[model samples]
Target: MEPILALLTAKDTKEALAAFKELEANCLAEPIYADTLESFLPALTAENSCGRGRAFKFFAINARWDSQAVIEKHLTDILGILDDSKAPTLRQCIPYLTYLAEAKPELIPIICEKLDSLALDQYKESMQSLIRRDIEKVLSEFNC
Candidate 1:
């Protein structure tokens, strides 16, 4: 876990990606490590995009592994990520939102609302399209 944390906290993108891959491999090998991975949650807001993205992905994986406790603890932070200025970071947050939608059905409307607001923002066309797709995907989950 320390090594994973070190790589994730590294200033370089390559190192952060390495951490992402390492966490992925570990999760695949021992799914229970997802719980332990929760310790990296605070890093999601790292100043570096690479660190934030990797941390978000790691959190998403753990959320998928077991959403109940993770969601209860990090739902607000996860929602807060949608407000990120970085499009890619916001995009990275979608799967976690999707997982939350599945595990906590009541949040679907709020999530969709947030996505709608995000889509209406002045992001590039390509990014807007991606946000639209995410909104569609989340709405589809609830047959909306």
Candidate 2:
């Protein structure tokens, strides 16, 4: 495994976060990191919340660099994270929709449909507003 990708599975939280930041920088600076997308996909469903969040960020950053349309091929699995039981994961996934939208504008309606289907009341009162805000921000971006 690549050093940065290897760090993503580190036992230490800080180490994983550092690896994510480094990966994010690389993805943002060039399309070279797109080859590693498959490796990060499993992290999306990792038991750890931070792991899931980092995976979301990974996909979001690589959306533009996804020359093979790999992200689009896995679009259903990506959007399904909106139904994740954890509020924090939902919060993390929602904002990344904007990046996905920029990469595939045609998916906006489908994305908005998924966002509208979320059960905000199922989350804690404090989190409900934040999650709603995240969804609204994305929806408003495309005026959906």
Candidate 3:
């Protein structure tokens, strides 16, 4: 678990996600346990966003925990900037959403507005379907 944290802190989402898979395989992953998840999450759920390399991973990792309270207690939030006017922020949201949709399917609904924002535009339907398919595949893999 510490190694996973180290990987995440190092901004190695790929490695961190790989570690998560291994932990899930063992049924030994821990849900976030910081008592301050609520306190900390607000700062991140911003309409404002960060630079290119420091991409945010929207939802808390949905790990298998010995304590269900840890999962319930955190109350993870997933939000995105759907305004094309905020192109950079919105674009940043795409990858963030991509990662979350796979890693935490519960956040799929959060992308709905963003999906619809592309509506009446070319490839909009395809965009919605693609992300839906991505989350579906992830859920199917986990048998959720």
Top lDDT prediction, candidate number = 2
Number of the top-ranking candidate, with TM-score as the measure: 2
TM values, all candidates: 0.70, 0.85, 0.37
lDDT of each: 0.66, 0.76, 0.40
For 112-144, candidate 3 gives per-residue lDDT tens digits of 444544432333555656644554454444454
Candidate 1: regions farther than 4 A off? 11-15, 34-38, 64-68, 99-110, 119-122
Estimate the lDDT of model 2: 0.76
Candidate 2 runs further than 4 Å off:
2-6, 9-12
**Residue-wise C-alpha lDDT for candidate 2, range 1-144, written one tens digit per residue:** 456545554444776767667777887788876776776667667676666666676788789888777788887777767877889878877877888888878888988898888888889999999998898888899889
In model 3, the runs with Cα more than 4 Å from the true position are 1-35, 45-48, 51-77, 118-144
Ranking of all predicted structures according to lDDT, beginning with the best and ending with the worst: 2, 1, 3
